[model samples]
Target: MSSCAKADASSSPALEKAALLGREFSLAWLRAAGVSDPEVAVLFDQVILIPAAQHASARFADPSLPRKIVRTIPWSRARDHHLVLAEAAKQQRLAAEVVAEHFEAAHRFDLARAQWMKAGETSCHAGDYKKALRLISRALAIWPWDEAADDRARVLREMARCATNARLTDEARKAWEELADHARDTGKHDLRADALHQLAILSADPVRAGELLAEASKLATRELGPEEAFRHGLAHVDLLVNRVRVAAAKLAFVAVEEAALKSKNPALQSEMLGWKALIAAMAGEAGDATRFVEEGMQIAITHQLPEQVAFAYKRRANIADYAGQYSLEKHSHNVAIRYCRESQTGEEIVCMGCLSYACFRTGDWKEALDTAREVLGQPDLHPGLRAIAGGVRGMIAAFRGEKASAFRHLDEAIRLQRAEGMVGMEFLTLWALAYWHDCQGEGAKACAIYDEIRTLWRESDDLHDSIPGLLFAGAHYADHGRAVQLADCIDIIGEILRKNDLPEARATLLALGAEQARLEGDHEACDKALREAAALQIKAGLPLEQLWIESRHPRAEDHKGVIALATKLGTKPLLARLKGEDCGDSASGLTPRQCEVLSFLATGLTSKEIGDRMGLSTRTVEMHVSRIFERLNCRTRPEAVALAQARGWIKLP
Candidate 1:
């Protein structure tokens, strides 16, 4: 391809040696590889080779030139060039993979194996798992197991590490299996235990993961001290939590705590206590969660455990979330991040994601969006943290009338959470999607997703953290007559509310009751429920939610208050919906019943009097009136009647 390939036979020998040095090489490396003639450097001046980064370096201008040159040389001469290049690379302390390539080209597999193994390890440390796996495979392909048993075992470990980090579960499993067999054969109990633990991490089935963890822990206890086994025990506890087996995870934690106590490890005890708080929070035991956080924080502070202190603060944020203490939740997440930064344990990313959730709950949309964007921008974030960031951004986008962005972010969040086996996290994203659809008046789409969430809630114990948000969504969906199972929402949530005095639970439950009353056409009961719910929400320090609840009635003052609150909070979606900017329907977005209510209101009849005339319940009349206000985008009955009159929907003499 290059003019050098068309060169005479006299120049072919020097070209062949340069080709063996690779397509690119420094003049010094070329000289070390035995093509030291000063004329050889000048030969590359004719554009077959070009200057490279370093002075006196040249790379073939045409990629195919090196292969073409190699083809003209005999394998015997090429082998000599390879040997020289390999020795030269080693003397210069080049990259292991580079030296390995040369040795492999020279057909010295024995020498190549160690260099390839070293290259793989370096790649693994660099987080280049794909390259690491390839290099490790090359080393294993020619491994002299009997002669270098220790190296073989170490390479196997590196292989598994690389594969796991790459999320190549099948390859990781295969490597771990081989490592386990080799460890058993060599009577290396520690390696066998580690293999079992790693295999457990790769397993998708929780039961199998638990079994492997148990065996690994037992093996570790038998060979080493109880301290060595504690890691396996804690991992099993985390597995149980991921599986949503909170009760089982709690019991597992007890065993882990016993091991921690036995080992006299304060750090382990602090970590165990932090996990205990998390499990309690997940199970809706807010009091227990708070107590556990306090205990964990005390131990972590006394022991000077930075990581455990971060853990305790993270769990405290969880407890605050469950208790509807939004301010505390935000504060705790900030504190956790501070400690996480000091520890450099990477937990700060998780705290940042949780902080976004807190900001969203507290109606700080700008802060929520900014914090989530920051979390999403970080590289190599854990899937669960990424999912949290995505969910928050999506939900905020939905509220900001960014329909396309809402779906894009929410869909990815759901996918990531599901793939990570984070069912609890998945429900939050699902609720956000369903609520967005509900707000858009897409009843079929809303109900479909709500049904899926309901089914999951029934099948798993993981929905406790999601229930508070679900309650609000269910009420909104019910108001639009798109609710999947109102009775189930009321029953399950009522039972939970009875069991725990969650600060937000009572208000959300009452909001659900208001929706039920609206559906039943009980206008008086609906107003009463909303009033009580709004009062509770206000008392709980959630003015945004309170205004939202008050807006269900849509009185002139209530509409003004909600619009003001939404404006102040930068809740663009809510403000737009209130202003009818997001409404796709015509000005006559009211039903026949709503028009009838507006006609009665035009006559200056009270709800009770209107109900008497229409032969309906008073609350039914009130419900119709609220719908008319919403559909007409009016803040008062007079506004609704005036709008209907102007639109020629209704007229009076």
Candidate 2:
């Protein structure tokens, strides 16, 4: 056995038995410590029993021990029944008030009031709101005039905050209003401002909320503290963002950033950086957004603010998504979710939605669908989230060939987004619906919606997604006789890619250029585009694009090359088809005669000169030229040449 076990065994039975006898244990303890009987009675009454009653729960599981000892008390403090009242207070505070009332009936006002206040504070701390409110109100009825007035104010503030935490909003508001009046009457501007701030957070009307914040901010000047000034500045910025006062918001945010930076407060700086990141994201300034988010993340980590770290991660994820860095987007989302607050369900749901979209971009359809459904199943989900979830579901449905279901869900999403006044979500829903329609071969109908989407993009200046928009427009616009407009859109896409230095987007753009070349019957330009795009995709480990370029290889001479690429890419069925005895899957949508004209055009040969070589009339050659233009959906020679090259019909020198 251990030392404790040995000590227990060797200890005297009589000495141990003293602990079981209530009054004997107390008297023995007093005698052993050399206290006189009269002094023992008085000390037990005033010093020992009162504190023992307060601390009994911490010291023993059996309340009977303390209660039994209390019954044997032969003395009292200011009153005789003090231990009885303490015993009652320990059992149930409200029942103890009867003991206090009895003391009150004997006119011992101080002792009675102390018991009532103790019961109230204890109940309040323990979160028994109803009992706390009742007891605290009763305690307040007998105010101590000799005590400082500040004590009363402090108690009233506690009552107010307790009601607030308990979600009795109206009661909290009333209490705060009373406190505000008292503070104003007493010339306490700080307390008045605090009351107004609480009222602002709870106000239902945006106008009233703004008014309250304004009132509070005027009262809480820079003299308060850097932390308070930072909070007020952020609130002012929020009001500006809500009212769409972008310039004013930016101007207000600068002041906050300067304050935090100068104050050397990492926590405050992190918060300001997060706000800056949000503004940059809204404006489609991806690089700026990324820089701000990263700075915030570093600050949050250095300062050990876990929640701020989470917000920083979320901001980076949003910027990565806007920049089309899908892998980075997913990673940032995971990190954000790892550190997010348990009660911040809405933020978690937003992270989930971002992760799902990231999966979709990286070609993980199954995980994307599952995550999207998880977003939909969240309780108390915002309608803005429903709009986003519906977009994901609609895209998945379209990919699986359920066009009607795709349209139904997307239309409903658009409706909800409009109802919620979520302009950003509304724009995305409309874009998704239009893209789906075009994917279903209704390019004409899709073009009608694209006009609005184009306008939205222009107004929002979100040019990062403009590449996909360019591709969609090229497919639909050329046939609709908007060839000049289509060319201009592609030019803009090229400029954006160059300015942004996005090499990943460059491959997709070059692939699109190949499509335009193929349309212009420039087979060589088309072959050049295919080779460059395939090479870029290969370097990026983008197997899907390499497989696509192999399947659509533009020349007979490039057949073995396509087969070799497929083999290198580990693409089984595609390689098998390319190497098969009957390689009929290599068929182009263009006819043999059109291919011949396209090849001649790629050689810089005029149609009339080609007629002399083929022994056909110039008029017949002109007829073929018109027919080729119609077939390839190109208006100009350059466009026809570019589209044909993208389709892989022409061989490059």
Candidate 3:
């Protein structure tokens, strides 16, 4: 018989005990000899050492082994080791039952504190804050008097704080409160400081929040040294920045400016300084805003925060756009786009929306559309951000004369903004909707929307604001022969322009004069005023407005002026519109299919019904309509049809 059988045969109690102790020693030797744990355990259990062998295997298979040792063991013995019996149960190995039995025995002898601590760490790593808390609580319960228990509890509380920081919902606020209670109970200075900081952030009362953060920062400095204090101070600065941003969006410029100036931290100071520049610009202090923004840009660049740098550039771009510095605006927007795209944050979406608007202002409608499409395509985009993207897309489509598509995007944007309770965007959306109506030749509807926007602005005490809405409304009144109303609107816009010392005010005045002259049938005055407007439009590189003026006159002087400007600008859309060609056709010329589509549009068919007749998708019909609008010097379906009728290209049925 084997040595094992001989050992079992001598079954005296002392001898059996000796045999069991020997088997245990032999297994240790085997483990040191590089035999796998599962194989060695199996070999020992199969040996004929009777109760000695069994007892030896039981001790060897205890799951209470150190983690380092358990981690290296083979799959079979992992099951036999009672330590990971729950995990072993998941395996389908033949030794699963034996492993489970060993696991049950080992669990009875296992320290709950050790298991809870291990589970807490694993859950924290996996971002399961709730599970981590549960495990830490278990550990605390098992060893309530231990220092290690307090440490584990503190770590779990910190994890909960991090999860709460992700979303500032009521549930997160409650979680933060619970974490603070735990921190205070444990008397861990670092944990207490962290809880205090989080409580400040979650506080709805801004004054109280700031006070709490200040105290937390001081406490952290006293307890955890300067580095921890500075980190906490950074959080305080971020909260202030958020509050300032909210104020800015509400047009509470004074509040934003004050808050920014009050921030003591260098980075926070730089950010607030930038916000001051933005508010100044919005308030029509262009020169001061521009100078301040230049300084802010330098500071942002020095600080090396890509988000701040992008924000500064975007603010500069807005200032430039307002001042009619098209080239400078384009440069600023390009820089903003670069910095925003490089940063891995949600702020990039805001930059993209600004860039899209800049592209639209520069008459790069295709670039604007492409950029807006990219922003809207992001899955994690905020609802407010997506609404802005849609608004930009609507503007691009409107500029391209795709009325249906423009309205579709604008409607979607309005829906999103309303859903988000974004009241600040309401006036802007109304302006866009008004412009869409104007494109479709529904002058009355456009004027009504403009009136509503004016009422909103007046009620909000923003009547003196130099928003683009004033310009659009003024132009619309001028177009419709409301000369007196137009003059009043012009005076309001002119006062704002004069206050800001904007050179473009001259062009707007000249346009208003020309419109009044045309209504009065004074060709000479109209011609002189229009000539001055054209000069300013050319100087400012505003081809869209220049094209509009020339399209109305179409005389030698007007046509020549437009062609020269388009040639100098190298703007394809302007050139095509001036030449009475299809905007969608490449320089190579229109295809036969394009001609057929244009013919159908000239007959006044909507794109949707046309798609059904042609057995094409509505998208394809939209593409053809876009092309037709571009070539025909028309910005709407009715205009295209009218132009076609005037040209005798199609009969009005």
lDDT of each: 0.76, 0.61, 0.58
Per-residue lDDT for 444-482 in model 2, tens only? 567777676665555443445444445455545543446
TM-score of each: 0.74, 0.50, 0.52
Clash count of each predicted structure: 6, 26, 8
Q: Model 3: how far is 480 from its true place, Å?
A: 4.4
- Model 3: per-residue Cα lDDT over 1-653, one tens digit each: 55434334533232222222333333332233243555443444544322335443333333222233434445554433434433333242313233333344444323445545566666667777666656555554444434554555554454455445344245455555665666667676787787778677566575677677766766665667545665665555444433333332333333333444454445555666666675566556777878887787787778787777887888788778667676788788787878877886556667777677667656676777788899889976887778877887876565555667879998998787655544445556777788677555456788888777666554342322234465567656655546677777667656656655554556666776676676677868977887777677667666666665554442433476667756554544335546655423332124546655666776667778778878888899888778766554347776666544422233455
**What TM-score, to 2 decimals, does candidate 3 have?**
0.52
What is the overall TM-score of model 2 with all chains considered together? 0.50
- Model 1 weakest lDDT span, ten residues long: 580-589
Off by over 4 Å in 1: 1-108, 118-132, 144-147, 160-174, 184-189, 196-224, 341-346, 476-484, 554-557, 576-582, 585-653
Clashes in predicted model 1: 6
Model 3 misses residue 210 by how many Å? 17
- What TM-score quantifies how close candidate 1 is to the native fold? 0.74
Model 2 gets an lDDT of: 0.61
- Name the lDDT value of residue 104 in candidate 2: 56
